[model samples]
Target: MKTLLSLSIGALLAGSSLLSTSALAATHAPYTHTQFSITESVQPADILVVLVPENAGELRLAGWDRASRNHINRAIEVAGFDGKAGAQLEIVAPVGLSYGRLLLLGTGNPADLTRAKAETMGASLSTWVNGTKAESIHVNSQLIANAADNHRISAALAHGVELRNYRFDRYKSQPEARPSQRYSWQVALATDARSKFEQKQALAQGVFTARELTNLPGSDGYPEAFANYAKTVLEPLGVEVTILGPEEVKALGMGALYGVSQGSHMKAHLLVARWRGHDDAQPIALVGKGNSFDTGGYNLKTQAASILRMHTDKAGGAAVVGAVKALAGQKAPVHVVGVVPLSINMISGDAYLPGDVVTAGDGTTIEVGNTDAEGRLILADGIWYAREHLNARVIADIATLTGAKVGALGSAYSAIFTQDAAIEQSLRQAGELVQERVWPMPLDGYDGIVRSRIADKINTGSPGAQAGAIFLQHFAADTPWVHIDMAGEAFVSSASGIHPEGSTGHGVRLLTEWAKLYQAKQD
Candidate 1:
């Protein structure tokens, strides 16, 4: 039997308050990313953000009046700020504008603009505003709104600001001062799109939630603690959260997953959060690898540089937890199930070692080729549990599984593996929409790599790095599954547009968008 993890509800609740869980509130708070406002005219603000496109030596402000356009043109000429994609120039208290400063932002060419660029620009704006004393921003999206249809530019821009503005200040005695909360955003020509803005804002809430959970110290939660945090945030959204302790997992014959947590005193768990908005539809399962902290077991990561940051090993589970919360919050008409297998790989007398054999819940025995390759071991059980117990028709698993993945893809894109063409296309669309890029990779002659001498299969291939997606397929049986190896994408050491410097909260938006598209097609 697997060692079971238990939740301390009272303690978890205490931590929940610290999480600042909801982004639904209109008024900004430390946890709340930012607030949205729609306006027909530019409001008097500390900063006026204008989106301008490149035009050689000539500056064209076609969207504004003659005087306003001429003033901006002359300023652009004098400042020498070409409307390049990321170019920015601040005009402090320009004569024609009511605001104290006119922030001229570049957008390449107006016709060539897209949602991704707009969002990145928005994030860039937020980062700049944070560094300045400016507390309010009035965005003039007049020129770029038509660049991307479906209000995509404005909606995505707001989404990016909401994302970039997330701050985890609960633990800070003197939290760094941020202008996001005290800040006000006025988007010109968006009065009619209040509902759309709110919807995008709601999605941002999910991304922020995932970031919070991932940013939390690994010491804050092992398997049990992670589940407790999920329940605390998800229960109020009316999402049905079921916690399966190690015993329950063992009962289902998830020996492969169970064996990983054998050495740790903190019990491992599988947390399932469900949102059954449509009764007739077959549920789509989102499985995550929630390795609370990995110590590499017997195959110690003694030479690892960032071993201390292993706390973020649960980015996948956090994404799953955040996805259901946002879906339920948005009231999307899709039946969804999220399965997060939570555990911590520790060093102890009882720790599972390399060469040990573990029988998975699906009855496939996995030879422990490397104890450090613990993610797929846990995912083996999560993937099976989602398929069988949850009756999930489609399964998508996300994990920070392999170091080789980081070496291969870097932070540019998460590696996606699947033989199914449709799954790849769906995820690709979702990733593009959110700026979280996914690269499709072939599962070449990899089956032979994991062939074992003793067990039915080994946990990993010979080189042992790029085998995550391939090894996971063995436990998936006949189920059509998509594995996202986000080793490089999940945690970022440097800040980028709309994304802070840590725990990227990578899969929440992609997973959410995929479910939305699936539901739309079904309808």
Candidate 2:
């Protein structure tokens, strides 16, 4: 970790020269004096200055005071361009002196101060300073206050920017450098003196940890390696970790998981992580499908679809582990048992055929209608084991389980299916708060699609490709469970806001926030 940190520092300093005071002042100073024809009194020293269009002149007056025409001063300098839209200025006077730089960011219209807009502006600012060497940043809360709840909005904006600014250049030979030296950052709040920034910080740490896990390649993040990583990350937080190897899984009668692992040379394992934050409480169980690589078994996927990006099928398990890490890191007052059913689904002579019949840990036999429908197969035993053996009160399983969900929801939101509406609503609300959307779909009538003619259930849908989410819900068996199919949103092909292209690290923030809320309600 120290070496990585050192490399990061070295990368930042390599391309740029030692920053000079005058040059630094020119680049880092906040106030830009560019001319603008406005009726309001604008001062460079003010943390937040109001900008109202000439049209809506009949607003409020207390937080708004305009100087006469004769009271106007020189030209207004803008932050970015010298002659573009308007002026960019930095407030470098009394209030901004300690902060070193104060930037007057431009909004084309004064009415654009809505919360979403403010967050966008914050994100833009963070992007502009990506490689720069600025330590702590303070933005005037007034600009975003009218747009959003000041503290919450600002914290989220700060979080988005900080997370976006993270770069994984550990292996780069000669990395480019940026100015700004504070490794740690502080976002000055414009509102609410009692905001929960500490909690938010912990949540941010958890998200970062998840990002790290998801970013690792399949070779480094296989079942055994992933389990070891989880142990190393969570055990120090006082979370009890248990890794069940192939022998233990077989002995425990996790036939569904074992059947899925029959094709791969690598052994299947189940990781049970328990964080007893409070004593004598029924744990909330999180089950994740850990298919490290999926080759579709006997029902093989195309070479284009199965070769390079197959590793990301384990992202669901990554999220579960990530959420646990976050929960333990924050020391939340709720017990959580995370069950990750880990394996590689490959095709071989010894691989289970499409017509094979396998029994789950609960003694329910399932006919393998399609070997490609393997995620649900593994998760079946995992969810059952978590509920029956661990005695879970609430169970939620996440997986890149189906392509149909991607077709239904696109890349914008993950599809959620649950028997309990309350849990579904909570998860949806949490996802909204974090800007990771989740849409709930029906799970009640979907059992009919998975009903088997010969066995208790079937692993897949009928001949056609309809209702993939519904078919996967059969594995949850009657438990109060929520199934999150993050197939589309788990990994991206390009960068968007805080999410990079490789691994979106989708559910970490949402699950962590939901856990916090659940714990609060329990308390």
Q: Tell me the alpha-carbon RMSD of every candidate.
A: 7.6, 10.2
Tell me the tens digit of each residue's lDDT in model 2 across 316-435: 888888788777766787788889999888778778898899888888898999888889888888888888889887888888888878777887888887778778888987887777
Model 2 sits at a Cα RMSD from the real structure of: 10.2
For model 1, what is the error of residue 484's alpha carbon versus the real structure, in angstroms, after optimal superposition? Answer: 1.1
- The best candidate by lDDT is 1
lDDT of 2: 0.63
lDDT of each: 0.76, 0.63
Which candidate leads the pack in TM-score? 1
Error of 1 at 351 (Å): 1.7
TM-scores for every candidate against the unseen true structure? 0.87, 0.75
- What is the number of backbone collisions in each predicted candidate, taken in the order shown? 1, 27
Cα-based RMSD of candidate 1: 7.6
* lDDT: worst 10-residue window of model 1: 4-13
